[model samples]
Target chain A: MVCIRFLKALQSVLDSRITVLYETHKGLGARFVDFAGWRMPVLYSGVVEEHMAVREACGIFDVSHMGEIEVSGPGAEAAVQYIASNDIERIVDGQCQYTLVCNDTGGVIDDTIVYRRSADNFLFCTNAINTDSVFCWLLEKLHGREGVEVIDRSGEYAQIAIQGPASLDIFKIAFGIDTEEIRPFRFIETTVAGSLAIVSKTGYTGEQGLEIYLAPASAPAAWDALMAAGAGHGIKPIGLGARDTLRLEMGYPLYGYEITEEFGPIEAGLKRFVALEKGGFIGQKAMVERAEGAPKSVLVGLRMEGSGVPRTGYELFSGDKAAGNVTSGTHSPALKYGVAMAYVAPEFKEPGTRLNMQIRKRSVECTVVAIPFYRREKK
Target chain B: MEFPEDLKYSKEHEWVRLEGDTAVIGITDYAQDSLGDVVYVELPAEGDAVTRGETFGVVESVKAVSDLYSPVSGSVVEMNDAVVDGPEAINEDPYTEAWMLKIELDNIEELEELLSADEYQQFIEEEK
Candidate 1:
């Protein structure tokens, strides 16, 4: 009896609200890790190999762990505009915008993509771990408001991202998408694998890519059709590990790593996403004050002059004085050197400023450079 | 996946080959496989001392960082500059070409504590 109970408990511990791609990962030499309570594949072959595959050709990502919240009602527009940092009024029907949900103190609560389904309906694509908190925050804020309805639809849907240089062609061949018409940051609903799905033109890679949102039950068929369609197109399945490096190479901010509750958009080099003139948003005044340009520190990119890959929380120095610390870093496969994104003092954020990072207790010289160490070519 | 018959292995996945007063050390194939593609490796300079079960160096993949521990106490006599410069070689041939260092042993008796090839294989099996 005790052994049976132990086995049952062990089964629960192992099973983590598995994604639709869970079975597919097992056949692909995937190594799994527990991330935010989800058993996520950290890699298939290796981080560098997968990184290069996406850079040279194309890559597919199972971003099903991301959450969704559907908001619709008479007062939905006012509620959304009051909640997010970006001006949702700017996004019309069939469009999406990357924005931040900030606290009253101008700190980032969560970063999300707002998909405008219609004038009064929007779906929020939230980070996996922050889904519950964002939903709760929304409910609490919209308590007295009568006309707006916010529903947490995170568990109902799954998401996928196809990224790289060859993404558009692969998407066209696989899904019959007419890429010549779809503008960036726009989305359209269509049938994929005999199921309803929302195909969007926004991506995190700084490359032209598309995001697909569909129901969980039909996600398997959709993924299978996609894999079969793109099998001969040099499309490799990417994992969270490579996804991290690819985004870091572009200096895109990861929520917990670069922008958190302790820092504002201005400090994380995302001021453009914040619409200061559009008042009535949460943290509007504090964001306006920050826009005055008196932030204590700013995000900057650092390339190691010496060897040694910098990791998160490593100390950074400018000459003899203590500077800042690395937030996210890796040995960039494309750049052929270690690249890091750090929040350093304003004086040390210049393009050519030389700094030092202590890797494994040894100080190594690094030079501050611009974000996006890699840029995709325009077609 | 290959564990040589003559080399002694540690639970931390380091393999050591004893030759007279000198000992050669590197990560086992199991270790290299688990670490994935190694992007960077940090090694102690020549003439530095290392103690048994202590961290002597670090190997970093694009995702994670792992400490390379010394299985036997010794003073480092030489370092593999090749693996330091291009760490992917360790993934290619962890036992031979990827050998991390050659140390002059301070206490050769420490070899008795290490597992034999068969025992190490069993240990890896048990871990799995």
Candidate 2:
């Protein structure tokens, strides 16, 4: 028994990948968690503290685990338009669009961001766990096609996100670049911290921020430079724990949780991102059928009225009937209450609808609320 | 992690301190540290009965949920409302201010099953 346990532990250690900033995170007193086969920092100071820093000040995240794929050649735009649910044609060069990739039956493969660098060059940022699968799916779909090339560029770059109200100022200070012209969803290829990087005005957290894609070897120096420049802006290193809560506060659908292969984008309340009018995509037919028919279930946000935090897989109830189940839930550090994203019967999707979540032996009351639970006021 | 020498420990990481016929129970420092930044806590009512080695409540952190096991069987006499209102107290001071419940002992003999402070320290070390 001991030998088996030892071997298992050894195997896990060998299998888990560490980011380039692993040593830096360790030095800053980070508590690590195994996320998608990567040993990532779950927290440095605390989840709540890091969460607040992003809301009020600034926070930097080592998101190097997120995968990057590049599609280039004359047929790049065609290849992307065929696979992505959103209309890539809508985004011009230097802009990006939040989109989804789906299978033949219209089930979501992954929620991704498609960046149009030029007419012949595009990039995809995919979820860490789904990176390899997404890469293969893109390759298989574009195989035998002329003038299109798909490459898995995930290992070549490390991604970092600096977010908050003060992000622009920090960016100017750290990289010596005037980001005043960089609108949301737009990016610029420039040198930062003595390395070539793609600085995109995008982030999962609903805050003003930039996600920088730079070479893996230059990540440590860039992280240090950002932190140093953000010192006066009250910047802190954020971890995955706060990252989940921050995105949850925005009511964003995480790939595995809200958007999954079993549920399409329509059921996940992301129909707007699916450009059904743009025909000939992989899942257009099924998605159009789903949009016209009554949905099996619809995603809604639940705010706890009573005590006890709702957790993933907990069943929701309306009266005595089982409504649905919680997909992702957490105590909102910003809201000071428990909030959750749940899939319930279509009849129970109204914002003010009341429901009960079965948490252990007790039923905790919650109210269906409009998502974007904590939206930032427009500056 | 500080393990009070006067208190007995359970294998599930609960600590018990006897005061006359009433026993005060809380999680140990090691347990609270393991559960970082507790966000919510649910405990039994004042009159509820708890059995030894059974879960009496739950402690939730941002990323995980953990059950609180009773080290000794008893009828709950009182619950620390402060800890319930602000669960971060458990992370701040698990031993004194975060004492979860005070219960009237159902079987004083259950204390014999618990470990000494030194034994618990050794146990956690071996667990790691």
Candidate 3:
């Protein structure tokens, strides 16, 4: 491995105005890109290669850019439930629930993963750019409350995700922790790499994997230990590039791309995660109205029939009519065909409906297909 | 990184080779290296008029789409259909095998604006 101190100095000299990775992703031959005001690695090896590594064997990702917020104290339970779109009461201790923070109009503020550590303590994993804003929002929500505390612990933690079919076994090998007991959405606070970490069995990709949230100071040791343990396991370091493709293939909604301030969970096909029955939350009325009324547009998957790549902001046309716009699209590295998720008219949201993706001045034909272009085979 | 000494270069990192009054144009090695995995290439058809320093085509990589500028003001004489058919040619051999277009020069004086191999090397260095 490359030296961390040397790279830290080199990166500072190179770009002085960006978030530096304390776990040392810079020295690992990662190609850094300016992502959401931070110099984050977009790729270490080729995206397709690293992607295949995750799908076939094992791959590790430095997802330290994801923000974390701590909400713990008296009445934290009710406060978290009020702030989140999902039913946080459903999860027991050491369980995570995928959720969304919504605007008053039911538009999604941000999609987040809320981990319930205890009845009075909940931790939210927010999107990197949305951390400060969400923290401020949480603070604003606790105005009438006396004991609830919202602390932005985004910078204090480093999140390393080891994802693949072999990720569980590899986790056990690397950290001497058996995660077989940690079923889907379940997590365990364990000693890993000689540091306390929360190993969660959750992933963006539709694979059995672990997301280890550890202290920033102990991240390098954990990363090194994982790498050393995974050396014989065909482990590759994945980057944000592969991360995009993997999540996209799984039909996962990225915050800005799919779930944004422009749309709500019902329109984004996250109805299961949104708990309207639980009630007593922001955007609850708007969500109820949306559920009772006809939505303007709904998210759907598209499979390209022709050759051109369908990218974000690409217009969708139904015959000669303007259908909608592509939110997140990519040439799916797994399928070897172009795949995309877009919001379209109600008529075009049905499967087998033909549409076109406007690339440059030309249109590439596509068809509305089911979401999640890839799913791992159950053993 | 390989900037052939024989071929001339433009400020936009396009290489030019003089074939009598005609100029063969393609992006330089540095250009392709930066683009990374050219997935799709869109080029103007033959007989299309292209002005100097204007977009003649677009090269789409896995990352982003970049406009390809013409090195000289001319009418397109020939098109390299290979790049449109298989875009990876641009990444594999951007100089010879992936020539974007051949233009019938409107004015040979435009060649004076082009840079030599040494000057282009310095230009790229300053850019870095």
Candidate 4:
């Protein structure tokens, strides 16, 4: 009876999930919040300050909450190509492709990055909340199929992303590896902080950066090493609050917000990722049919002309007619103005087209603008 | 979080400073600290009627939005334009510089219902 009561007390105390770097975050003065059933840091110094740090200098993020799934065997290539919307064959070893996992109805299951490891090995980095569903979907789809195995490796690795213009220098100082030759969407497998890790030249922020995946046990040491090395370059510990703002400034689609099971990739303006000509893939037929028909709503970027921030689910209007609604919206720290991504009628999709966004009870004027609201200039 | 002795606090985390018939209102330091880096603020215009315990405006942080409730019901005499232009000031000094509105008090007795500095501190402790 004592043991059972103690176990129940322990279970109650450990209700919420936490990542491997939760202690590290708490030590850095992170503000904790309940995110997708996980106790994650929402901010440290501040959202705007950390956001500017990533844009101007360097910032590190704990992305261990992101899910990782491995598919390996002789049939891995065939299975991946059938499920993913992107052409997995296009990426060689050491290359990653931004792709979408779709259901049979052509709705997005999760937007993911597929890394080609070898001829029969591939890894998928999925959204944190959709990890289990994605893993189950992959298993159910590939059930009874020979020679392919799906394994969830989410708990095996801790992911860290270092972003900004100064990330390359910090990475070199910390890892002693030259990443100048590694192009975007490419990764290299090597030892980082005495542990095998995969360093990829990819990030959600529209800045030059690298995402490192390594063993969870080695993450704290690796994070400390990077922080020490990056101290000279002004690297701030970024939190998920700044992460959302950074990605929002780039008009990147968040899983639950911009891409959902109700909307298809074509309507979400991700038709390029869907390989329509390459038939036999799941959702290809429905996606192709969607591509042919006139879309009911199209996702477009909105720049606020009036005061007030546009929030998700806010109704949008073209003159007096109800057009659509906002999916993801934020006050852009980089632009110093409110910006949003909304799904609107096709007629109101053109840049400079005027629209009214209902923020609370007030109707705020906004204009349709081209996406990628803030793009870093290349040297 | 610093709660001023002269200012009365509401259960909704708003502070009110009674100046004769005028009541200056703003979010408390505890409220601003909890909100974290306020990005935008929406305030009712001057001459707008406000009711006690009702949402008079909104304060938006990077990740969340919080409603600012009225401590005492009255007519808005003035709304702070400086705070509206730069919402981050709330995080810097929520009490003085970020005062949201000055209202002509409808009932001075309403201030009696608010918590004192010591009471507000105890309330926040219990809240935590």
Tens digit per residue, CA lDDT, model 1, A1-379: 3464455446647776678879888888788887765888999978888888788888889999898998899899899999999999888999999999999989988999999998889999999877877887898888899789999887788888888778888878877877657999999999876678899998887777889998878887777766777788778888899999899899999999899998889899898899989968999998888878678888999999998888899999877898998999998988889999998989898999988898867889999999889987666
User: How close is every model to the real structure, measured as TM-score?
Assistant: 0.95, 0.94, 0.91, 0.95
Order of all candidates by lDDT, from best down to worst?
2, 4, 1, 3
Q: Which pairs, if any, clash in model 2? A: none
lDDT tens digits by residue: candidate 2, A1-379: 3464456456656888889999999999999999877999999988989999999999999999999999999999999999999999999999999999999888988899989999999999999877877887887888899999999899999999999999889989988898878999999999987789999999989999999999989999999999999999899999999999999999999988998898989999899999999859998999999999999999999999998787889999999999999999999998988999999999999999999999998999999999989978777
Fnat of each prediction?
Answer: 0.94, 0.71, 0.12, 0.65
* Interface Cα root-mean-square deviation for all models: 0.9, 1.0, 1.6, 1.2
Model 3, A157-211: lDDT tens digits are 8888999988888888877788888789999998877668899999877778999
For candidate 2, the docking band is: medium
Candidate 3, B1-128: lDDT as tens digits: 78888888999889999999899999998898777767788889999999999898898776667899889999999999988999889988998999989999999999988999999999989997
Best by lDDT: 2
Worst ten-residue run, lDDT, model 1 chain B? B32-41
Per-prediction DockQ scores?
0.82, 0.70, 0.35, 0.69
Q: Supply the global lDDT for candidate 1.
A: 0.88
Summed backbone clashes in each candidate are: 0, 0, 0, 0
Docking class of 3: acceptable
Over 4 Å off in model 4, which ranges? A1-14
